[model samples]
Target: MTVLTDKPESPFYEQLSGIVDEQILHLQDARGIFLLDKAHERYMRYYLRNVAEKPWNNHLLLSALVYVDKNADVRTIDELLQQVNVRLVDLFKIFHLSNMAEFNVETHMYQYLKGSYYQEHSDSMRSKLLALYRSLTYSTRKWVTSKLNSDQQSYFEQYLLPMPSYDSRDFSFTKSAKDLAKDTRKNETDVIVPLLPQIRAEGHFRWNQINRLRQTFLKACEQAKTTSMDLPLEFHYDEPERVGERFYFRLWDKSSFVLNHHDQFSASSLTSAYKRTGAYSEGNNRYFVEFVKAERLDDDEKAEGLWFTEIFEKGLIGRWNEFVDVTDDLIQQKRELLYSWGYGKNDFTENSFPFFSKHKGILTPSTFVSRNKHLAEGILFDVEPLYAAVTFGLLAVDIFTTTGARINELLQISNTRECIRKVKVEDKLKFSFYAIPKGRDEVEPFYISEQTMKLIQLVAKFLKEHYGTDKIPSVIYRGNRSHLFPEPKPYFFQYHESSFNHFAVGACLRFLLHGLNFESQEGKPVVIKTHLLRHAFATEAVQRQNLPIDIVAKILHQRDIEVTGYYSEPTPSQVAQSVSDLHDVISDYVDLDEAVLRSGEELVNELEEYKQKVGVFNNVLGGACTTNFVCPTKMQCLGCQAKVPQPEKKHELEEVIELSKDMEKRFTEMNLPVEVKKAKAMRKHARNELKEIELIEKYREEQKYEPHIQFKK
Candidate 1:
């Protein structure tokens, strides 16, 4: 066994210092690396790590180990089994329950677990905790048991096998289809629907404006360099005169004016010039020219009223201390000016520059200038924050609503131009992006519209240019910066400083919704959760657009089509409409041509009497049986001519056809001639029924027929 000393410099050292036992740290995995070392570096970074929440899977696992037996040196699967005994489930329960209780001291865990409370933490918190415990235990057990010897594995199976089910035994309360739809619309869809167009428009506008400013700045700078003009050359003809009431600082400078120790002008002289004209230093020899309005200026000060534009010029004033002194004097003078102008000095303090602190790194209005409306008119303050919010917010909404991408998959989208691919489908091309779905190692193509692909590419280009990097910076997923991805991928959905992880993207989305002031049908303010957008997408696809459930499942990257069914549950109105449409389709199927039946009145009466005589029984494949007494063909409605197929059940018929084909192939391989013949007959019947249903649907689509004859059974 390799004896390893704890490295204090390790990032995990602090988190593990108090919670983990020293003996546990000494334990080794199948590899020579210490268990704690592996846990800190590699184990938690695996696919099981919870992306939606904080990176605490390793911490929780270590805590559980310590709780089981701090002194037990659990080196192998057998040893862990011996340590945990048959109390593995109990151990996790105690750990999670205690943790939840401690975190939520106000609520009683016993009551919460037993379903007494109606607060947010009642059902969801319990469910999440149970899921977390189950996931952690399964993952840890799999990792340990994989390296065990045959005899040891057998020993584990015999004694401590059949892991206790953590499935919450409490009564499960499920929402009805109507209730689910109502809740979803009131909470998620309605909120997002109103805000989407607004966000898209605003985001697009801001993006265009940012690009315009960038282009104008580049051109003005080039012009200044070529012309050899004095500092602060204004361009009145090219750019917009105002961005509201504020004038644009269309001035250009070839190089920053530096006032070093050898310069003739002192910091005091620059401060005096700034007091008369709204000008201040923006460190690194850069300064912003504020175009203050004439109304704010003193009568004695013979200076043009200037307001501060977002554009900054590279020009130095003095040393750090001198600059600070100048700023302090200016602040004092501004306060006196405000006080003399009947405004309170307390309202215009250093802290009032919230915009500057909120957006520190990005280009924003100068921090030195007060953001009071009276002081600066039409100045684009909070430019970067608004830009980031609107632009990123729209990108996230568009991607989520359009592609039905989970938050994690959306965040991990590669920044490369090749991320979005175009594949030729017959005569036309379709666009898709490759993303690693949750719980899967392999990547899947998420097909998106051409328009959405263009939007993503535009955002990617802007991000690359803004960061001045060839690619967007690599994002650290869940704080496991090293082991999350095989290599650093420049994730597209990120800010300059950090990636827009689940929480950040959520915050961005909420920020956009908050501005819209949209209200739900419940007459409450709209608050949208990001994941609900996925549900909305699925629901819309299945219920409104009538897309197949299997197709939606594939788009959502769900392995189970049943899960997709839960997402796209039809509302009551939808169910009624589907029933009505099915009635119409059935009626159309039974309709006789007037051209063939010349005795119309007698034929109609006979048809009505015939419909009453036939019995309608619900068949297995969502069709109705017209047999009066019993199913003479032993419920094989597919081959029966009396079986009336429903439009909504078309997918079920298709699935049956596929299953029959598979069975026929399997029977042939087994040399069962009788079974193969039966399977082939079943497949043919299902195909014929499906084709008839398609023709009926086509007839219904081509001709809108009001229900003239009502059939009763």
Candidate 2:
């Protein structure tokens, strides 16, 4: 049991408070004061020693202190103060300090009114403590800001302010893919583009092509091994980074004698796409297709020699045929294995997979699953496209579009965690889900549509059926390695074997959009990256769904509405259309003072066209501007003296007068002085503008058809 008492004037607290106040008033060196705060240090040490458990890790304080020291500036100081304040609040709560208490400077004792059960510090002490904390924080910030250089201050402010890290890999890759489509429009294709069709061809054609090529090369190598005594019978694929070189093979049609048996031939045989450069293969480990003059193809072509000789004689080789060496063979041998590659027919295997196959009940360990499971089963399933459609197709798109989630957030929905549930919202039950997204400290529940929920379920079911377990590997990679953290969870978004990371997810999205030939309204290939999906979701929520920007921010789990507002920024074309619309709406009311619109008599003819294009723009009913400035006053166009109402809009101006009167009536019912005062000012401005419009209308009516009255020069 703990005994609590208050003595109105404690000497220790009085000295501490006095020291803090004095330090705040005379603060100069922020770093020095922070280092010398014995009270704060003592509290932190005590907290670590006594109360640090579970969530209260000592590493947090250590990291925070290090971060503040490294970034010793105003922003860092401010962040430190916030952290300290939270910890202080936690400390106070732990001690059960609730009542009001005052620290008397003269008597050196804390004073408080006692309840029957216990004595505690009064609210005055709490107030003083908070005030002192704030003063110290403010002083420190002021000192640091005053001391910082312009660049440091600017960078600090820019980084400290809430903004999305938009250039994440998923976002950048989508933009790049869109750019590639643009290049295609200009009739310009990079070397990779031509090879893409070979590698990313429909169905499992690329895989089959690779397999046939590999078999032929190994057969040639085995023949050479029988003759030369030292060579591996088969070759293997290079690492993923070296995959590009394996595709660069030259075709040899079945006419010239190249194989031991003509029956071993396919439609065409492939030779090493690599050219035999006389340069030693020691440092140049990568394969490049070089076309050499036929010195009878340099003497070592076993099964592939005759094919190369025919191409060489026909002058088919050139300098422009260079490709990146993606050869799998890393070992250095005396004899070149470039001669050890030839083409062969693909070996047919029995197929058992089916088209549109359906399975019921729970998936088990015996599920015969592979990337090409459908094709292997000979079910006429286009497994390539289906693999993408099943893994990162509809569910991914729905989660991204509806939830405004970052890519990682969307991927965080694993079946291992019982995330999706029916939560009551607005007196109706909806399927909302939970995910502990990146940067967020804890699990946040996000409400999703029923369609999205179903899509998620479908993907979940597919993942289990494909992997034979609900527990798929988590997304963890370090440097050149993946699966570093091997703890398996039922991840919703993954391919046949890979646990989807940013790169895999991005590649799938690009492939899907490209395969589907998707395009954006901007006449460009649609950018389908994860962050773009989030932005698109936000934009649609505000522009189409009519959800509040703040609500969108909440759904996206953003810190502020300002960050969410970035997605809603208008494009140039959108701004241009808005200007056109505004011109059409107010053209009937205001006289054209600018020459751009009044250059010719064709204006009357174009009036109908403009109206047709803009339709009957009605944003003016609440007053509007096309410039997109965030006006301080909501009803800015109505009340601004520089933008007074024109005579032609008198009917609308009269409606504005009525609206202002109604607002005034409603504003009088409000008790808040500040809001009432602001509303009154707005109404007063509206009335003044109304009077001006009426006067202008009366003058224009009188002056009608009186333009003939001209002064003598």
Candidate 3:
């Protein structure tokens, strides 16, 4: 064995001194609310009460004290400590101790096997409590720091985190002198023992009865394995603590004990652990409570959150407690945790056990990804553009859809200049879609401008730059005039929120989980997932200058699902530049319909001359000159060929004016039921009148300059 011997300047003792001091202080701080101690206190109390025994020291504590601290060579003792034959604790004056039985004065002898080590537990004080004492309160000084390695210091601190709820004593012991005030027996003046505690109205245990029962249990359950189940433990008789309850054990768990959907303990686990290890189940067991368990904490046993070989030795006749195999217990725990989320072992890993377990690590991508589609995609993630696309896809879909749209839409170009002289959308721009859904005899259309067309060109360039490096399932976009979503692998992200969130949050969580070596998959982790991205998008939708929720919702396929909302609109600055860009396109083409109205007024001024021209050959006949009697000239048209310009209105101009008024009316409609046909007819009338006015105005303008036009008036 490697040993750090004395006489060196920087000796083992000096290095460990600070760490050990800090550890002790931590232990003292843990005196209250530590799960391990709380559990032990309960078991101890229960056993003691059941047996009805009063002993100075507990067997469990003695074993620990003797096992960890003793050095046999430095101290020589005549007393022989035969492990198989040794008693657990012996009286040293009034307090019971294990070393007193193994003590030898001759050579100042103390050996680990001879009782210089401690198991680091008290029947009442917990492992965490003891650890806290060791780390914080154990020292007289208020502050302590670690000189040990960082890992050791971390280990020291971790052991002290409190269980969620304080269940009081693990098992009640007979009311100790500290808990109850002394009272002399009424019949006998000299005899004194604490009275049974006053029972509360509720079923919960009172302090007196709880402590008394705890002690009784320890005694009754002593050597319980080879002995009867009816251990010598019971509460002091007092109104039964309540009407019907026989017992209660304090919870030694994390604060999340009361959270939704947890495991239930049958009280059998305590006995099973103790019987096997002579150590109660604590940190590595159900005792941990609410916090997510770290893989580092996975051990058959832990002392102050440090993994160690938990065994005992005493002389050649050894009585080493067996290691508690929590294999089945852990399996049950994992299954229970998964079940709460509506899944079974069959849902996750093929073996249903995490590949990177406490004892197993060489898990490869194949085994780790296994059958999980979401996980597999996540595993394939790199800094590649596809990674951003897939990961961003989640948030994007929530903000917009393609729920699984690929990058194909960003690639194609259309030459619209070939079809029309003036392109409705820019002729230079081409549009296509990637991962958009298709229908029979129909293809999804993408509205691309020059900017998006450029984005596709960039994607193509990028694909070429990293050609043959594609790790994805397949590439679909290549030629033109096609749907980007090709055959075979249809769904990129399956329809599940957990899978979506997993992709988002799992990025970070998986990384942290992996670093701590959790029994889960590990790779270059993405710290954020899709929903978080969606959350960002949602927040941006509400808080940023993005499109309104309704429009965004429609983009994300949520419009049909929502009800009426009249949210405030944004100022122009907040909108994406694309809206402004589209605005510029429209502003360049000011509606000529309004300008046409102005020209119609001029034509109306010369309307009579045009009437003469149609019949007497002066200038022009404007479809017999339809004129608006609804116009400003309406009163002066008594002998007019057309009293209203509506008489000569063409079909198209009428439609434009009608469309504008209908749009204006919709603003005030607000779910108001109205007849569509009647509304359409009124709109049509407004348009037709405007058109006739335009025609009459044009006819009058022609007579003003034509060869021999003369006004009838």
Q: Please, what are the lDDT tens digits per residue for candidate 1 over residues 1-713?
A: 22456553445545555544344445444344444443324332321233102223233444333322222211222233322322333333444643321333223333445555434343444554444444445654664466555654454332122233334554252223334545656355544432333344343433444434344445555665576665554432121222222224433211222221115345664554444333433232232332323231223533222212221111111111123333666656554543332223344663112112122233233343222212222332333444455456667776776557887678667754345444332322334577667546567876554345556655666677678876567765432222235455677666665655455576556544433445555555545556677776666556654556776777689889998988876633332011011111112101112223336575456346434533332344736543333344455555442344556678987888789889999999999999998888777766755655554464444333221211111
Candidate 1 global lDDT: 0.45
Top-scoring candidate (TM-score): 1
TM-score computed on alpha carbons, candidate 3: 0.19
* 341-368 per-residue lDDT for model 3 (tens digits): 2224434342222212111111111221
Rank candidates, TM-score, best first: 1, 2, 3
TM-score of each: 0.49, 0.31, 0.19
**lDDT, candidate 2, 1-713, per-residue tens:** 11323221222233333322222222222434342221233233443444243132222333233333333322333344454445444444544543213212112111111111123433333333334344443443443456656654453332121111222232223344444444432221111111211211121222222223334443444444355422212222221221222222221111121231235333333131122122212242221111112122223433221222332221111210121221223111101221121111122121111111112211101111211122111111112233444245445554554456776566566554355544222332234567654434367876554334544655655565666763444543211111112355556665555455554555444433333333433443333455665654555445433446765676678777797776644322221000000000111101112213343555445344433431111134323222112222244455431131434555675676677566766767765566666566655655654554443343333323111111111
Instruction: Please give the RMSD of candidate 3 to the true structure.
Output: 39.4
Cα misplacement distance, residue 313 of candidate 2 (Å): 28
Stretches of candidate 3 exceeding 4 Å from the true structure: 1-539, 542-550, 559-713
Candidate 2: Cα lDDT at 270: 18
